[model samples]
Target chain A: MLHIVNKSPLERPSLDACLRIAGPGTVLLIEDAVYAAARGSAAAPRLAEAMQRLKVCVLLPDAEARAIADRLIDGVTTVDYAGFVDLVAGHPNCQSWL
Target chain B: MTEGIAKKFMFVNRSAPYGTVYALESLEVVLISAAFDQDVSLVFVDDGVWQLKKGQQTKGIETKNFSPTYRALEGYDVEKLYVERESLEARGLDEGDLLVDVTVLSSGELGRLMDEQDVVLSF
Candidate 1:
């Protein structure tokens, strides 16, 4: 399954909840959730840990929209909307963690 | 409806309108997605029930009233709109208060319907 999270970790527990149940699959961060992938942010360490166990990715357009693309933490892959569609096609199902 | 590839897409709306852009933006995606010809269904749960409320006046907030646009969805062939009964009752709203026609379902039924979807997008 692909877990898509679009809320900022600072504002909501969506990211934490998503990480708790997300096992060995892909985690695509979009909208405000991309902040979790930024280096030195509160969610960076948790994201770093998640990266070791899952395929952690951030939507490039969203990250760029928030101007955090240049500050993304290590081990986080970036993809565009086409990649978003591809991820949906590749995964059996998707759970959007709002 | 793509030839031999019509996937079930369920959009879960859990946020209220106006306070955040999620509700309006989700509607935009829903409208654009109609061209994909996929089986699209919308589930209004939690605070999302507010999006369907009638008599919304956005003039005070200086924002465009997007609620009216929802009525045009049926013209785009995007119809399956569902509202969680518990959510509506908890919010003190009833089916009659909604601006658009929708099927009211219990959360359990909504969950089963969600389980059947190939894609679930929440906003």
Candidate 2:
């Protein structure tokens, strides 16, 4: 399964719920949720810990748009829109953390 | 309308009811999805657990009280409802507080259940 989050961790509990509830799946951060990929942010450690159980990916354009492209944590894979579509297709199904 | 291809669908609700449109919209979507004959389950976590709290008085708020519809889900054969124990405890609510009966599971158990589903929808 693919877990997609679009809200910032600071503003909403969407990412927190996804991180806590999702199993061994791919977590693709989009929209404001790309902030979770940033190093030293409040959502970083938990996201990094989840990496042991799930794959972590960030939407490059979203991250770049927020100007946090260089601040992302290690082992976080960046994907474009095509990659996003492929990730969705590759997984049996996905849950968008709204 | 494919009669025999039922998918396991788990709808994850994590927002407070009535504060925003999410809870109501999710309920509407769930009802529509049931027509497809999918194996549907509803999971309430975080503030979403509040959606099932009994005695919702929306008369003063002027919002149509939609909590009653949850009781009607079983009629649609969408009887699978699960709530996170941690969430319930945090909110000081128990099974008796909810309008419907639901299987309460630990967050860990809930994650495993989520992994088994063919589709997960979050609201």
Best by lDDT: 2
lDDT string, candidate 1, B1-123, tens digits:
458788899898878899999999999999988888989998887788899999999999999999998788999998999998877997899999999999998755775676577878887
Which structure among the candidates has the greatest DockQ? 2
Q: What does fnat come to for each candidate?
A: 0.42, 0.79
Which ten residues in a row are the worst by lDDT in model 1 chain B? B106-115
Error of 1 at B52 (Å): 0.4
The estimated TM-scores of all candidates read: 0.61, 0.94
Report the C-alpha displacement of residue B86, candidate 2, in angstroms: 1.8
Alpha-carbon deviation at B1 in model 1, angstroms: 9.2
Proportion of the native interface contacts kept in model 1? 0.42
Q: Write the per-residue lDDT of candidate 2 for residues A1-98, one digit (tens) a residue.
A: 79899999999888888887777889999999999889899999999999998999999999999999999999999999999999999998788888
Once fitted onto the true fold, the runs of candidate 2 whose alpha carbons sit more than 4 angstroms away are none
**DockQ-derived CAPRI band for the predicted complex in model 1:** incorrect
State the TM-score of candidate 2 restricted to chain B.
0.97
TM-score of 2: 0.94
Give candidate 1's whole-model lDDT: 0.87
